[model samples]
Target: MAMLDVKNTKLYISYGIVGCGNMSQAFFGRLFKDNKNKQRRVIMTYTPSNTRAHELADSIGGTSVKNLKYLNHTEVICLCFKPQQLKRFLTDAREIDFSGKTIVSILAGVDLKTLKEYFPNSPIIRLMPSMPVENGQGISLISHTDDVSKKVLDELELLSSKHSMVIKLEEKLFDKLTLVTSSGPAFVYYLFASFAKSLEEAGIRKDNSKEIIHKLFLGALSMIKNDKRDVEDLIADVCSFKGVTAAGIEELGRQNVSESILGAIDKGVERSRELQSEVRSDLPNLQ
Candidate 1:
């Protein structure tokens, strides 16, 4: 592996991403496209099947390696594989020397403790990025082990902040917040789809309804950003007393929509914990 060169006193961070899934493509694709400083680069991309690896690597102008041995050449290794695949991946790469390298994991429900058990000598950083990163609008939750160096942490922050709003969080809070930052996009999309469907049923053209709902969300978000008023105040401004919007709001409250949303989040959090337990059971030796 070639060591990082000193260029203007700044160290270049090379990443070896292990999976070529949608989330990986969304985050890394935007990062490579918008990066102008040339301080960060994708060294290699590896997957169980070489096809997706080749595709992603070609798109980013990085190498596509068929073997885990090539990962040793990279400075930071980003584990983008599914949490359930951790055991298989670790078993396959058991011989690779991850000792001085930084491991950036985006495997949901896989905690730092589990990762450290697999790669005891490596510094692990857990990152959970939302699906909106594909559009260059995302919220990423990050946490790291104590052994990670300040330089690596700063570089990761800069790299991630290019396509997402980075927030530091305690490792224990990761699963709970993953429901919000990671899974929230799908929930929002579901809500929009419901609204669009209602519009379509109310005599609007399907395409027009979808577009109107899209623009509605965009405008509402813009208002939230530009308006200084509280969210409740903004909602109040939208709803006149006993008006159409107020009627709908009253019905939603009557149906306990807020409680339903909270209940959904609770279910997701419980599933995350179940996944962690399943992973531990699968790899009992690591427990």
Candidate 2:
């Protein structure tokens, strides 16, 4: 078991990472941002055709291992590859022993059952994290096997909370949460881009239009975060009887925008399920 060393009121741990991608960058970036846990180092890393491993290792004072075999003795492994890459990664990692290790998988649509099949000797935790984790403000949806020790889970939760909100949910509800928490940022970005394009069409400077839309979103998000009142009530505050905002709200209502957005989310959920099915079918009986 890895133990934490406390010095001058700080704690640190030793962990390893597999697959260094954008999401891994966000997670570890946030983890190392804080001075206290900056000492909680990544001891090893493996990247598939990316400079991320060496780059991150150099920045964090760690070693970049060319082969997955280096992770065999790691106490905790953060699995950050795509769901579809699970089988390929495992095949490439045949020489790496996962016995008694704790595997934290951030692959979307790969559930606990499938993870257990691939890393039967390790306790698996399925986590869905967003890109905002890079700034220490995101949400991580997690589910774990029953065999995980309470101490390990607590440590994992603390590690995640350093960068984002961590919510524990059953495997059944993870796909639905993935739609909002995981993919929702892109949806919001798309909405803002569309709004910015409209502003540009109205003769606003292109750069100004983008900046204005960005601040508009940042302010709204801040308001929602700080306000205690319900979102509907807040909307009511903005759309009080027969004003410009009211006209916009009326037009959106007439176009059934709410239903349209919900429909989009439903479609995303369906695709998530399909991906899960495809991965499971491809990697059946991995053990």
Candidate 3:
């Protein structure tokens, strides 16, 4: 399996991308660059309307075209389109024969059952990925139908897991996991920004305050990722014997900020749930 090889997956005029968006760029740009994975040739062309997608082709050893005509019957395809645009793209793409192709999708809110409707015969997969694939900083949860080729799944896991964390999950579970990982980064960044803003309001030197906060976060995350300790244990380590960190945390709790953040995360999870239904179309604009 390509995942096990890690260093090399065969390159081919195979593996097509239906939409070349931010998430696609992040994942491929990270995976294909692994010196070992470079052996695999993946030739992909973007749909015509995505004018800006060409910038990624050369980097991924792919191509840019005006339509889906470049797709072959035996190719592997990844769908990176917006939820609102999913129907139209699938409608136009239906004319193509996807007999031997495997379809992987990153469209949020939509389920595998809905995706199967478009490419019923093809092996269908649903994946939830974060935008950090650009830097290989996050994880993607994947769910595929029973009939999917093990070889294709292995190749994909090799590419995807290298750059982003991979979790082989059930289709129904991604709705919530998408909220945890898909939207979690932005939420964490928002919290950091809020703290920065508060420090600024307190008349701290902007540069010094920003650096302090940024490093505090970066260092904390580094520990969490490397230490293998539970987050609560880490917090306990920092808040030793009524330390300043503990006092600050107490103040935050008194102000109800933690409750607010919990509420916000809840809203984020619910919004992700709403996204799967066609009735929630136009969500990007809903904001």
Candidate 4:
């Protein structure tokens, strides 16, 4: 692969990923999946173990660098490491000069303020991407500091828009959006598993139950997306007076399942805030 000329304004933005975890792999893997004939985007991946870094780099046709200093050439540095590891990572990486580069962080609880303290000269962008990006179907919520240039923002949007719906919002709303978009996939999987398990208990084969539930969800979501009627109206369509579906709906209401789901979301949002506070408390005082 040709070395990217960072000085070139027309070339695709080069990315240096500091952590090669699942999310990073999935996100970048999908990004580079269709670049067979085109110039592969320059991506420098690094991790302490170097195992995942090499794996991701190989899969994406990018380079796996040995350490942080090697990433200085890239225009964008994506911090995909764990939130709790930020302080330590910064300490170990103190020698690298990050001036003028864009710091894109996907850390769950680490906010932009803390990132600004670490990379004072670099523009920071906080992005929250859900798991579905692995399959090129995902939602990403982004918040950036005022210092970020429109060109860089446009480049990021161009890269991510192909695989995910990118929504730009204020940093203050990140935690709430994280609950719905970031943590939402797991919650949805839990519901799917619960329904599948119930089917298993009712004597359906486990594999068949899972497939059935998967298709069921896809069909329901398709209707919700395409149908003009309100969701309640669609529910009404499924539920005839004193019918089997109506009986199930009645039981769900009686059991407060809807309320329970709302409460769970509330708890998730609370936990997100608490995690943010904890990560903030761990940051050392800025010199």
Point to the candidate with the largest lDDT: 4
Quality of model 4 by C-alpha lDDT: 0.85
The list of candidate 2 runs beyond 4 A from truth reads: 1-13, 34-42, 284-287
| Greater-TM-score candidate between 2 and 3 | 2
TM-score of 1: 0.92
Total clashing pairs in model 3: 12
- Give candidate 2's error at residue 205 in angstroms: 1.8
Report, for every candidate in turn, its global Cα lDDT versus the true structure. 0.85, 0.80, 0.74, 0.85
lDDT of 4 by residue, 1-287 (tens): 12223443354678898888989988877877655346567788899889999998888777898878888789999999888888788876776789999999999977898889879999999999988988788998899999997777777766777899888998888888888888989989998999999999999999999999999999999999999999999999999999999999999999999999888878987887787788878878776
TM-score of each: 0.92, 0.89, 0.83, 0.93
Where is model 1 more than 4 Å wrong at Cα? 1-9, 34-42, 284-287
Sort by lDDT, top down from the best: 4, 1, 2, 3
* Superposition TM-score, candidate 2 onto the true structure: 0.89
Q: Write the per-residue lDDT of candidate 3 for residues 14-104, one digit (tens) a residue.
A: 6777776677777766666543246456566575565645766767656676667667633788788787787667567755788768888
Clash number by candidate, in order: 0, 0, 12, 0
Q: Model 1 Cα RMSD, Å? A: 4.2
lDDT of 1 by residue, 98-189 (tens): 99899999988888998898889999999999988888789889899999977787776776677788888888889889998899988899
Candidate 4: residue 118 Cα off by (Å) = 1.7
Pairs that collide in candidate 4 are: none
List the candidate numbers ranked by TM-score, top first: 4, 1, 2, 3
- For model 3 the local lDDT of residue 22 reads 74
